[model samples]
Target: MKYDFDTIIPRRGTNSYKWDTPEEENVLPMWVADMDFHTAPAIVEALQERVAHGIFGYTKVPETYYDAVVRWFGNRHHWQINPRWIIYTSGVVPALSAVIKALTDSGDKVIVQTPAYNCFFSSIRNNGCELSANNLIYRGGRYTIDFDDLEAKAADPKVKILLLCNPHNPVGRVWTPEELRHIGDICLRNGVFVVADEIHCELTYGRHDYTPFASLSERFQQNSVTCVSPSKAFNLAGLQIANIIAADDEVRRRIDRAININEVCDVNPFGVIATMAAYNEGGEWLDALRKYLWENYEYLCHFFTERLPQYHVLPLEGTYLVWIDCRASGIGSDATTLRLQEEQKLMVNSGTIYGPGGEGFIRLNIACPRKLLADGLERITHILSKN
Candidate 1:
């Protein structure tokens, strides 16, 4: 590999949300989605060059930025995006909140697939919209959407938006083109707008290819909004940069207004620089990173199968997050997380926070060096084996 992903860069004193949040010393944090590895060399170099300028003024996004985004998605994923259709924002979470605010009324409803991302719930609630969960079916250690349930939910007149997590979080399943088309057809028939949070699109593994929800059809593109970012792929979450793609003119205008109203329209200079660098020159590094991440996933699966066979690790098609079934422990997800933290000083996300169908599962992030990942897994085994 051209890039080194094996090195363990110390993040404890860096005030990292994933590491510093735990007060205990020597606590291993395998919770947050952000990677333990450093970002692509190109991105780091670009940010350093910008910092050397010392201007620190508000940034005006250049045409080159749009070109990089368009070219990257077009060449890599075959999703052609017009520069005019893109709206830059601070992050995907902010973009989602703004889209919900723009598309729905105070009393309107939004449908979300559960065991979904926790932020999806907060975003919908923050915008004064009701959450209608179309829970994913968990059968035989895999998750699948209940199309009949989704169709029923979308038919409700009050349900104005269907929030989609393409290459889904927590339970990582990259929706196939056929699956995306089915979703699009249901939304189109029910007059529901689609808001696809595809921040994890570039992190897919093996045979799973991420299909941009909007790329399915012209009508789908016109009726939906997509929020994407290099933050997840490049470990640039702190940089706070993302883009919203809305092809419809009126819809784009309303979302832009909501972005400004929400006070997330402006992005920092470093974020812009890092984004352009990542999308333009970071391809090689990203490919290596995905390979490392997939290997880490396989290592985790093997670890579970050997030492912790009682817990079932779900098939990870996309994203670095792995979902493990802890039902055999006969404890709630929150308790399982607490025990891991208190007993082994290892921190991981509780599945209960991810909403329905997450109660018996625990989401573990495996985007770290093999040594660190081994330590986390050993920690889990040390604590859970007692049960």
Candidate 2:
């Protein structure tokens, strides 16, 4: 079935964080991770059916929801997930906080790769844990793990958990299996726990492969907690559902206990139905979306190369967020975002939010209609050219 990815959806005045927040009426929001496209038909249908039943009350996560999740990872990524190992959560970010609180004590240190998802910092901080950053080595317009540095941080006794982004945000790297194994080894050796946030795992493009940290080895499985959801893949962020997969019984028990204590164990009716529908019936829609997103990436690259050669766009391996190096123009990401909003009425994420190595960069969300992407690019070109 052909999905309508090209249609421009009107989200303005819809209380959309991406579109409605800016005070400027003319501003076009190209920030935030949520896509502008509508969710898959299957998800919509499932939601509609549930709404038709009209009983909105307390809910229990059915056995079918767990089964669909198990089937999804096994069939798509060759990672077999036992239904018994899956724990429900409202969202991955909240789950991270809960996991941190449950596993590590206050004042404990958490290891985070720099230039990571901005939420990693907050999640660690909110739990009263200090951040031990192993900054990624950025060179030649790409980012790589500084393993020697990572090992050093892991060796610290206070560092009890490593909060990991599997296909890292902003820099857009789908970490290879070897890199993941090396990371797991270092964490395991140092007696540190791993929380693999794989929310964006299914959105990879081209030949890039995403390795789930838990699927690496029995030892790695025991050492890691994998967080995944259909939220990002099927555009169901509003549904607020995710899974925390822990193969170790003890780890699962602690997380499960944390879920109840935190009062986040209750699954919403819509999230449960939408998630099952997405995993079981949304494959074809996802496959087509990946192609469309890759093409959008290609278009952005070509536009920058031909019309605005000074701007450097990092190669995108996964996720629809495009990380661009704007240091050539001598503008920091915050300044760039400001000028774009004021000058061209374009809004984007300042890279500084992603942490240490993210200076002088900007992240643009390309998961929208091509017409919108082209317009944003032109506006960006105009603003940068003036600067």
Number of the top candidate by lDDT? 1
What's the number of clashes in each of the models? 0, 0
Candidate 2 residue lDDT tens string, 239-287: 8899999999988999998899889998799999999999999999999
Error of 2 at 250 (Å): 1.4
Residue 354 C-alpha lDDT in model 1: 95
Q: Which ten residues in a row have the lowest lDDT in candidate 2?
A: 378-387
Clashes of 2: 0
Clashing pairs in 1: none
Give one digit per residue, the lDDT tens place, for model 1 in 26-128. Answer: 8999998899999999988998888898889878999999999999999999999999999999999999999999999898999999999999999999999
Candidate 2 residue spans exceeding 4 A from truth: none
